[model samples]
Structure formats: structure tokens, C-alpha cells
Target chain A: MGMCPEHYIDYMHDYLDGDITREHEQELKKHMQSCVSCQKHMHELSDTVAFVKSATHIMAPPHFEANVMGRLPKRKNVLGIQKWLRRHPIIVAAAVFFLLMGATLMASYPNDNQFSVTTQPNLVVDGQTVIVPKGEVVKGDVVVKNGNLIIEGEVDGNVTVINGSYMASTAVVSGQIEEINETFDWLWYKIKKLANDAMALFE
Target chain B: MDALVNKRIKQVLKGDQNAYADIVNLYQHKLYQICYRMLGNKQEAEDIAQEAFIRAYINLHSYDQKRKFSTWIYRIATNLCIDRIRKKKPDYYLDAEVAGTDGLDMYSQIAADEQLPEEAVEQMELQDRIQYEISRLPDKYRSVIVLKYIEELSLQEISEILDMPLGTVKTRIHRGREALRKQLNNL
Candidate 1:
């Protein structure tokens, strides 16, 4: 019988584990008696197992429980909105999708009532008067409807007046000023306003 | 105990915030031991263990009552330990030395009055050597060995806690034992 050291080492582990059959156990025991290296290997393996089994148990530091409890975040109310969203991810996703959809639809839909206005302080409209107040400087487009434009300041942009008039005193206008009083222009404006209001509802 | 833990969990979910303390107290020692064995640093272990409990508390509603609470908590702790290990630079020699001093210092003090000076020192040295070697093991093997030997968990339970197959756990354990044997031989 060829008794290899490596083979014996494997058998030694099985033997220690009590998984070896009687026949194999007998063979291994016989080999151990004749093989010095295998005997040494078995002894070392056994010692290692013993050391691991006998290792000292280290307890957690004192006041470990108190420390942990104190450090714990204040328990959040489980019924909070964040917890509810966590529990119902599908509902959260739906809510997000609807929110984004509404924003996109609102952005794309035309609203004639809502006109883009320049944020420059020079373009000021108070009630029916679009006034470029004295000593003020405007640097963008100005559109006014159903109101008069009073200019006593410097204007550097286009001024459009619909169903209204413009008056300037020592005011510098850098862009064209137009008044839409023709029937065709009035008819076009009304048609465009009606179409926009209808689109706003779908949006 | 499991039934009691489950009941506490139910109370906690139902707005009894104080009930969580029972759960933390029940598992703190075991979780700390696992962290200590894995990190080989008392301070890091405490921090990680405490963090694990806090995370578990926050996510308590997500915890399925059908599952064993111990397994769930252990998984959280083991994951936190692994993340910490990965983020750290590999410093086997430095970590082993620091761990040796910290661990040996405490044990040596305790054993000083009980045993002869020379014998206590020798025993403490041996324990330090074992700890250093254990710390030197690869993360995979170290985790399995700590869970199996120190934590005294069953192979099946370890498998569940680690989210690993039983066969893989066994293989790692076998490899870990072999590595430790080599370290012991050198000693």
C-alpha cells in the first residue's frame, strides 16, 4: 500500500472529524505509526484546532448597551411621509412621474396670457402706464397692451403698444416703437389669444 | 427569545420606540464580538456595531418579520465590517501590531494578579500571536472563521448571515484553517 504524506494528512482531518470509515481509519492509524512526518502533521493540526477552540472570549466594553442605545438615532415615526414612500416605492415612482409630466406639459403648452418679460428694472409697468421712469435705463424688449407707455428715461429696446399710445420726454429710444391699431392686427391678436387659452386647458 | 424579539419588533413598528432598546441589548454583545474579531480593533468594533444597530432601527419597517431577526442584524453588521475593511488600506503589519498591544495590554493586566508573572506573559503572548495571525487572514476566510469559531454559529446559519452558499463557506473554512496552521507552525 502506497501511503503518501498528503493523502494521510487528508485522512487525518477526516479522522479528527469522525467522518472516516473504520477501514480507512485503520489504514490511517497504521500509516501514522510508520510515518514520522504524517505523525508530526497530525499533531500540529490537532494543536491548531485546540488553540482555536480554546481561544479567549473578549467581551464588549463596559456600558456597551447604554452607549449603543444613546447613539441610536431618535426613532422616527414610521407613519412619516418618507417612511410611507419607502414602503410604497411604486406609489412614489408614480407620483414622481406625474409631477414631471405635469411640468413638461405646462412648459410645452402655449399660454398667450403668460408673456415672457425681461427682468431688467428699466422696463417697469405700473397699472396702465408702461413707464421708463426718469433717469432709468432699460436694455430689453418691452411689450404693452391696453396701456400707455410714458418714457422720460433711456430705452435701448423695442417698444410695442397695442390699443394704447406712447409719450416721450427727453427719453432715448434705441429700438423700434410700434403701435398696432389696424383691424387686421387686432383680429390676429384676438385669434391667437383664443387658441392659446384653449391649449392652456389641455396642458 | 426569537418570539420575544419578534414581539418587540412589532411594538417598535407600532410606535413603541423604547422597545428597540430590548432588541439592541439582546444582540449588542454578539454583534460587538463579531466586529471585534473581524476588525481586531475595539474602538472600530464598537463604532461599527453601534452603527449597525442604528441602521437596523431606521430600516426596521423594511425588515420582514418572517425572517430571523438575528440573521438580519448579523448581515447588516457583517456588511458594515466588510465595507470598512475594503475602504481601509491593507496594513497587515501595522494593524496586527496595534491590535496586539491593545488586546495584550488589557489581558496582561487582568492576568497579572492571578498567575505568575512569567506564565501570564507567555500566555498573553500566545494569544497575541493567534490574534495577529487571525487578523492576517484574507477578508473572506477571516469573516468565515470569526463567524464560525468566535461567534459559534452553525454552518447553515453562517451561510444565511453571509449570503453565501454552504459549499463556499466550507471551502473558505478549510482554507482558513490551512492558513492558520501555517502561521502556527511559524510561531
Candidate 2:
């Protein structure tokens, strides 16, 4: 005897939420006139709504504005390095990553076009081409700049060619053979080394 | 007033730090009320309200000037309040008795100083009970109820403040009212 039609219950809630259509509201009112259960339910819902609305609003404490003003972080330099860094974390990350990557390119930047090479004890130098003879043993690292390196014998250390090419013919080298042809090649060499080192460490 | 608020925002952007004081004053009471209703403790309400204002000032440049500043500030305040409610350990105390109100209750603290009429006092005690019930609601429903009824915001506004769909907001409001209605019926 006290149950409301399911749709009528929905109507009651929709009315209280201020979302009921005019037609539904009229229908609900008419239904409520002959339905004690719906009337009681509507009264209960409205009472709770009114009760919350009637809650006593408190005043903000005195000096609230002063407190908020005081707490504003020292904005002397609003976009100070540290604050800007904190706000744009992704940009900061990308900036940092690229900066470190650019460091390799900076080191490889050609300051001059000088043809230079570290002499080997048993090496033959022909203009811009440095060659280790067929049976000679180089004592230390061989670096050729603005030139080419031709190794046909044993070199006990690394062979780094800068702004040039290298051809190893029956060469026995104890270290890495790095060919840095240009700025970009140097950057790629350093990046590849870094990535390999990182992977090794993680593994 | 919106024009004035936008002006203050511009001045603050131009290194006028004191211009933010106007914003703080204009919204302090309204924000404090929402904080108070979300968290029934006077001390926490004041602290969160102050924090919201500080955060807003720090991120003032990110605020879209096209929209009402009130909504932006309210969103910040409500988010802070909801975070606080979630951080608190789930309190399952089912008591709504005015006598069972805790020591940190704002109403009990000020009830002594208010020499209100008999009817007013009774009404206040009732409000205290309602506040207790509101605090006991789950965080999801509690925010919707407080924003809708206590803050008297429209459904659209509540949706924006809570960053939920309007349909989700409506569903939460309905469920929250049912919960409150059941509590009143039991009482």
C-alpha cells in the first residue's frame, strides 16, 4: 500500500535535483496527491536538501587575506631558474638530455683544418696519410686529424681518425677504431657508446 | 566583479604581489565554507583554504581568464578537500548523536560562545549532526553532496569542480541524497 511506482520514484528524485521536466513535475504532483508513499518520500528528500542548505556558513578567520598574501612564495624572480625548471619538467628533461648529447658534438667541432697525427715509432707518414708498415708495431694510440689512417701491422692501442677515413688491412688493433667524419658522426659515435654502456649496466 | 578579478590577475602577473590580496579577500569566506563543510574541523578548513589560495597564486598564470575566477578557485579548494578526505583513514563510526561529536568539531567549539536563541541553538545542533553524517559519506559522494547542497552550486558547476561527467555527477548526487535520507529516517 505504500510502495511508489519505480518511475514515480525517479520522478521524485529528478524534481528534488531541479532536473525534472515541467510535464514530469506536474505528473508527479498529481500522483502524490493520491499516493501517501510518494508524498512521504518527497518530503523526506526535500527536508534533507533544506537541512543541508540551512547549514550555518562560517566566517573566514580575521587576517585571512594577510595570511594568504604572506604565504605567497617569494616571487622575486617568478620564473627563476629553479622554479621554471620545476614547472616545465618535461621540457627540462628534454633540454637536459639534448644538452648532454650536444656535449659530444661540441668536442668534435673542428677548430682548424690542421693535418695532425701522433707519430708511431715505426710508422710512415705521407702528407695527410699516416700508415703503419706491414710488420711495424705502434707503441701507443694513433690519432690522425684531417687525414687518413692505413694500418697493415699491429697497433697496440686505439686508432681514431677525425675528419678522414681509415682502412685496416691485416691490422691487429687492441682497441676501438672510431671514424669521426663530421660533427654528426662524432655525436652518433658518442651516443652509441653511451647507449651500449647504459644497456650493459642495466643488464 | 569578474572584470575586477581579471584586472587583479593581470596586475599580479605584472609583478604586483599585493594585487593577489584582493583575490584572497574576495573568495576567502566562500572557500572557507566549502572547506569547512568538506572537513568538519575548523582548523583543517582554515588550513586547506589558505593552502588553496597560495597554490592558486603560484599557478595564476595558468588560469584561463575567459572563465570565472570563482570556478577555478572553487575547483582548487574542492580538490584539496577531497585529497584530505581520502588521506584520512576510513572512519566507520556510525554515531550521529550530537553528544558523540568529537573534540575537534567546530560547532562544539563555538557552541559555547554563541548565545543564540533556543530555536537557533537547536537548529545549530541539528546542523552539527548533519555535518557528522556528511563527513561519514564516502569521499566520492561526500564531495558531490557538499558542493550541491551546502555550497549551493548547480550540477554543471559541481561537475566542473569535481572534473567528472555531468551524468556521473548526477548519479553521485542521487546516491548521496539517498544515503542522507536513510540516515535521517533512522534517526
Give the candidate number with the greatest DockQ.
Answer: 2
Candidate 1: residue A197 lDDT (0-100): 87
Model 1 chain B TM at 0.81
Candidate 1 lDDT over A34-153, as tens digits, reads 888787777887887777767688777878878877886765554576667878999889999867755654554333433333456666777667788888888887777667888899
lDDT of 1 by residue, B137-167 (tens): 8889899888878878888889999999987
The C-alpha lDDT values of all candidates are: 0.76, 0.82
Alpha carbon lDDT at A175, candidate 1: 84
Output the number of the TM-score-best candidate: 2
lDDT of 2 by residue, B97-133 (tens): 3455654444344313223344544565666766766
TM-score of 2: 0.62
Question: How many pairs collide in each candidate, listed in order?
Answer: 0, 0
Give a tens-digit lDDT track for model 2, residues A1-203: 24666888778778888789999999988998998877888899999888778788778999888888888888766365666787799998999889976975677577699999996668899998999999888988888889998999889987889899999868999988899886787677668867989999999
Error of 2 at A132 (Å): 38
